[model samples]
Target: MHQEGTRLPNEPVLKQKHKKRPIKTLFLEADEDHVAYQDSTNRFMKLVYVHEGYDLTQPRHQLINPHYFTGNYPGTDNEELWTEVLDYIDANYQPEQVYLSGDGAKWIKNGAAFIPHCTFILDRFHLRKYCKRAAVGIAGLDRTLYQWVLPGQMKFIRDYFTVRFNDLTVTASQLQSLKQAEKYLTNNVSAIKDNGLTAYHGCSAEGHISHYLSRRLSSRPLGWSSAGAQGVARTRIFQLNGGNITRFLQAEQRQASKQAKVTKLDRRLHFK
Candidate 1:
């Protein structure tokens, strides 16, 4: 019997290149608060990840992932919590770019250093909240000014303040108020600029936090178990990532099938 050498197919093999998935930029918002437990205290850190170009018409806005870390609030070692959270993000998502928004907390600023590559933005609504409180408390301004300025009236307020802040020679009281507002604005200028374009009242991140986490946690004076709190927070993140869970699952399944097929083929060719 003549042994025939196997020849590769003569037909032009079409190498269909897989199109690269578009790079997604994620907006990350995080906050840590102490949650009371029955016998002890738990510090819960929540992260909300939002991607650009995600369809908002779905049930939840395009939340990519939600992560929660809970532990006993270590006075000075809380930074470790931030490090763990950053490591989780880096491992799971591998996001192209991250934009962080948060209330002006010292821990938030300090923790952010862990993810130095991320674009840190202050929570704009928090900035306005501080400004309004200062306006009323220190400047002796009325509710009307706060209401108007908290909305998209920042430009008008800034212009008005520009003239007013200059004209009124810096008195002790005025100086105090100006200093307060200045500090808040200086720290949160980027968040304000990014959010000011919107006609809405509050920062989107703040709204998400209130709706998703705060409403449930702050509804009544209640204690939560560390595991239970972490579970709920994690679930909320998945919910916010929208209905894309199905798509993600489907993609994962397809990849697994493809990998399995390759493995099976390799085994067949190499079998003794």
Candidate 2:
């Protein structure tokens, strides 16, 4: 936020339910192996990967794998990354329209703004999930809630939550969820309204992020150093892109060998 070109932050970190705790988690004590106080951007890790697919059921992320950035995630890196993706798309394919979908994160929105003629869609998966969590909280007091929202009774379900919210009967958890939903909706009201009225495809980035990045880097009891995390993330992304992992390993080995020789020369000069 202190940087020159940073637009005002619009992403909600306040109520985000993430695998790694909030940025405040960076304050803890760490043993010699790891660093204390981790944020969304930095972690150390490793991975061994196999191929993944984007089938007919979930095809939006077919061409590109999730690109992981380690250490600090800066806007410059994001801009350059998005530019590379766009250039790749333009080089190989013809498209009638290009639409960008994300979790209403400020960085995602900011990046989308730079692309010419990009249509921004608030990801349906997250929108629905947050609304559902909020709705359940709103109706937590209703014993007969199961009967109130059947497959064809979505309108009733929506109204049920609305009425409960108005009545001030929501539980604490529901209140937080409601706040999240409201902020998300308020921030992207136009998108929410249009989404309700229009027919559009669902987004699979959430699932993709979980499968490709979060599972490997953020979830469970695992922790990461920035370099190890980035090295594995790069390798995973390469595998997803249909690149040869063996070749990548070989290149890394050559680079490492050259760097080791340089370090050896430096040590000899220092000792002399």
Candidate 3:
């Protein structure tokens, strides 16, 4: 068992480095799960993945060779996570382009700067959310917002909201909602436009969070220590990546045994 506050090292799922190959397009998606610590405070466990588009044969489209990284990373560690992702890309496949989809979080966008030939695409979930909230009063407004987005005419939506917010008749609550939606749209203008690009595949970060992180970490009634949470998350990802937990454990045991014997031999030689 890990001591309280201890964090397990973030380990990659691959035992051996990927054999380099060429891929025309790669998709990267990221999201975070808010989990409760034992003391009741919450921490965001961020998850990021890279895949070779999707497998259409599956009833539900499946990612092809998705590898994940998860942790309660903050500040510099967040950069490290993205760096590791870039390293993985460089080591494995030579992709002509990489599309990163997320909710326009600053950390997620930072990845665009770190990786070459990377473009940021805002996920539809957050876009729809802001559109709904901003369109609370008008019937069909949500649909209208999405329509404008589809054709890449974000300025129409912005101008419409700006005109409405300027009206003295609008309520304070309505104005607040409009301002928030506008802010989100403005900050992610490039990402929003990139969504229409043919190379961009849709994002399933939320679904992944539910399946990979929330199922064990937050969906339950239990609170976890820092170490326990990270451990469970890593182990879950390992299994999802087709790792056999039993084999991994047995390998770890053998490695530990060898290390122990080496230590013992060195101590005996030193005493003599």
Best by lDDT: 3
1 or 3, greater by TM-score: 3
Q: Candidate 1, residue 70: CA error in Å?
A: 5.2
By the lDDT metric, which is better: model 1 or model 3?
A: 3
Report the number of the highest-TM-score candidate: 3
Error (Å) of candidate 3 at residue 218 is: 2.3
Tell me the TM-score of each prediction against the true structure.
0.51, 0.56, 0.89
By TM-score: ranked, best first: 3, 2, 1
Residue pairs with backbone atoms closer than 3 Å in model 3 (clashes): none
Off by over 4 Å in 2: 1-72, 75-77, 140-174, 193-200, 249-272
lDDT of 2 at 199: 28
What C-alpha lDDT, on a 0 to 100 scale, does residue 193 get in candidate 1? 62
lDDT of 1 by residue, 64-153 (tens): 334344333355435665676665555445556666667766666666566645656666557656666456434555355445443446
Q: Model 2 compared with the native: what TM-score? A: 0.56
Error of 1 at 202 (Å): 9.8
Give each model's clash number. 1, 6, 0
